[model samples]
Target chain A: MSELTLKANIDRPDDFYADLLAAHEGLPKAQSDALNARLILVLANQVGDREVLKDALAAAKQAMHRDPARS
Target chain B: MTKIFETPLYPYERSADQDAAEPVRHPVVVIGAGPIGLAAAIDLARHDVPVVILDENDKVSWGSRAICFAKRPLEILDRLGCGQEMVDKGVQWNLGKVFFGDRKVYDFNLLPEEGHHRPAFINLQQYYFEEYLVNRARALEAEGKPIDLRGGSKVTAVEAKDDGVLLTVETPDGPYRIAADWVIACDGAGSPVRSMMGLDFVGRVFEDNFLIADVVMEAGFPTERWFWFDPPFNKGQSALLHKQPDNVWRIDLQLGWDIDKEKEKKPENVIPRLKAMLGEDAKFELEWVSIYTFQCRRMEKFRHGRVIFAGDAAHQVSPFGARGANSGLQDTDNLIWKLKLVMEGKAPETLLDSYDAERVHAADENILNSSRSTDFITPKSDQSRIFRDAVLDLAEHFEFARPIVNSGRLSVPATYDGSPLNGPDVAGMPDRTRPGAPAVDAPIGNGWLLSRLGDRFQLMTIDADAPDRIDVEGIEVERLELSTNDDPSGALAERYLGDAQAGIYLMRPDQHVAARWTKFNEAELRSAVNTATGALSNRVETPD
Candidate 1:
């Protein structure tokens, strides 16, 4: 019973994906990992709600372990 | 191609003061004849104050510098009597486009509201700006207004005393001494006057260099500000493009720290960069080239006993926001009025402290904004760069992220909120005309509101009753009566009165709101004026 918005919010996900990939180009593995870490922190700060962040963490952890072939 | 800079506009001449045995004393002596000094002298002379200006150079600045002039400064120039010519010759535009990588993320219009007289901004060379100011000074001098512009007169030393300051000025002939009751230092960032008095600015120095190339070209690009972040040509740096008058385009390319400063300025190295930005077939001629690294810093206080500092001498900001000259103009706009009042003995000397307070507040705001823009352009760390790129990436399609992208918040007049000079504010009136805010311009009949308010203390009444004039302890406060019917467009009422039916406002000479009320009250009005002119120490007491 949280007020966090969990839905397909992005209008054009493909364009955003391309931009994200382009931003990570010409970087080493360590730098790219650093970038992802920074990006997560930035987006988390933008979200700002502790309840929403907790929900997002739980959802992302669950997605990491789900079976791809069965789903 | 000889330009205005080559001709000596105010060359060295022998003066009578040099031969006198005793040092000649003047009412006010201004150091540095740049935009700020010239403006201060002109404003003082316009008010019948005798002033003198000293500068090392005899002509306008050499190259096209400080291209962007904001509307507020243009309005200030109007009060100085040179705004129309500047607006006529300047390339006016309000649209600005921002690009990330190669694709444009968003664009913005600075001034969307109508009924204002001046445009949002104009791009003109610094040389032309100084030329226009010098012309105005000459006109004032011809009419026997007390203003002396002494070229090639450089101050070698300064000494402050209990009541005045003595300046040792080195000229082509020899050194001469002059004393003034007050000295204004409009000398730039490396201020000799400040150094002589052992004063320093405390702030940050941005560790990046930008290459400025003013090129003459015939191109069809629209007159708008175009800013790029990590363009393909630059490949990890920011760039800025602006169009100036006389077919000259100003281009700024960010170069990382620890680069060869002199070798990059060579035409051989600069031409290839231009070719890469503009295709090989495109033709252009380089007019001037320079590299600059900026510092965001300001003095602890602008007023130091008898010697006062204005403009770059008091504060310095990065060039991203075009706040340098624009803020300097506002500095003179804020200082001259207070100084005039104090010199006339109508107000106590404490009035000058408000200048230091107000302009220092403005300097901090400018520094904060320009520093943020610099950080966004050149991220200090890899993590910061990642977050910056993330903001840019999300900004391409998302509406919420656009506000986070900072491509230099353009210069606007500072509202002296909580300033010592601010008087009082009513609850129900519009916030735009609140205490300490500059009067919002509105079309009143055939003229503008700002034109009628400034130059003296004013009592502006809109659909309210007030006297024709009031004398506040020998200072005259004229009344400007207006109604919604005066402005057929209704902008005046909308801007001045929101939920209220009528309003009365007390305005300072600088046209900032000193106080406002829903109805006319003489006692409260007198108290507000006293507070604004630094005549009263306590807060305004409202009578029950």
Candidate 2:
């Protein structure tokens, strides 16, 4: 059981969504993917405590894996 | 006597030409009486060009807008005869301290090199800077070269021409019209002249709004700049503190994009923010408070046939790095010299094209730095914030990470890296002061090297005598005899004569390096000047 928490953290989701899209605007598909990869590693480092990073990683992998609701 | 820091307003007077029956024509007309416009007038007067400046307002800046004056602008002011006065009245500082929460990340130094006339930067309000320039312009006016500075005169209409510009101006008394051989728009970021032409001024707009408040307090704060990412009082946003003259402290707080700007500017709302940074019991009165949002924008082209744009009128940047005024003064510096030559029929009309080329490059550089600093301080995404925080945290431990921390990289002079005016880099050339770079100051005998090399083409030959009867017109040879150890500090030798023993160099009137060679010849120097003045080509290299 990963101790990762997903909550409503954003104050305004609409503006955040627009900004996220703006960041990826001029970038090519491959470059956008590279930016996402770098962004993940940076976030992992700030999650500083390795246990928290592992927990976040497990939660992210679970999201990407076969649908949990369907399973 | 209570110390009065408020700026005195100058009364607008009726110009002698207001009653003229015919439209009075001038060599040049400068709009807006800010630092850029006054500099244009003063620089033109120094070159014996008659100029007239118009400003709608009679007073200087209300607050301490553009508090930091960089070294390059200081040098330009020094040439205009107000540099020393500004330095005498302003507080000089070079060190800046950056912090993450309660811990100091790193302290950095600017202008490490010595023997220069001006310091790295000075903290003075925009009012004082404008006063000095206005006084200098008046002094020039008394000496036969008249700079007619008209306040309370607003330009209502501007029509283009094949050779000149027709300006319809409205004064306090009545409406009048004037014509100029050329018109320069220095009317600030909300430039009316640019808008009259229906030009699109567009760029990236940062969503973050900053609350800048100036407080008059007697607390013993150091003169150096202090910037904190997330201090104890402020939870997540960044803050900055800097000391100005007259016990005034400038505090900049990052108010998130969602705050009410009108309510935040009220004294009731601003006092608490100041208390949070200073103390609960801090005895301070708010002198000024304003909320500002920055945009990094510029016109598509600075030159519009007979009309031209400069300073904030042409381009703008975020105020975080103090690039606004510094780069604007650079625009006047680059424009006036070329305009003088062109008006005098000495240089071709194409010389003005280089002003557009060089300053647009400079504007882009400032915008890039300012935009990046804004992103670093106010990261949009959590991932972006994570990287910023990681840099802030790692900066405390790793020396390599310290350079990556960005808290408004202080303004430095722009280098025209690949300018067409640049000549070939000859043997034994120096690095920073290379071709297309502004000349650096060093000690030469009793005075500084830059003082001797004013508004004329200078040929400084180190350790070697200048050749006699050099046939290139307008080129003045200045022979520097720095015989090995004569320059005890080796500052002159290092800047002019490279390590490989290169001695001869050619400099443009604006003090940019044109060409350099060990051997002196007339033909090569002439060709270099032709290139420097845009004589060889008509178009500047546009970015692809």
The per-prediction tally of clashing pairs is 0, 0
For residues B455-512, write the lDDT of model 1, one tens digit per residue: 8999999999999998878789899999989999989988999988998999888878
Give candidate 2 misplaced runs (Cα > 4 Å): A1-71, B1-9, B468-486, B537-544
Residue A14 displacement (Å), model 1: 25
**TM-score of chain A, predicted model 1, versus the true chain A, to 2 decimals:** 0.83
**DockQ each:** 0.13, 0.04
True contacts kept of each: 0.06, 0.00
Q: How many Å off is the CA of B315 in candidate 1?
A: 0.3
RMSD of each: 5.8, 9.5
Query: CA shift at B385, candidate 2, in angstroms?
Result: 0.3
- Scored against the true structure, residue B444 in model 2 reaches a CA lDDT of 61
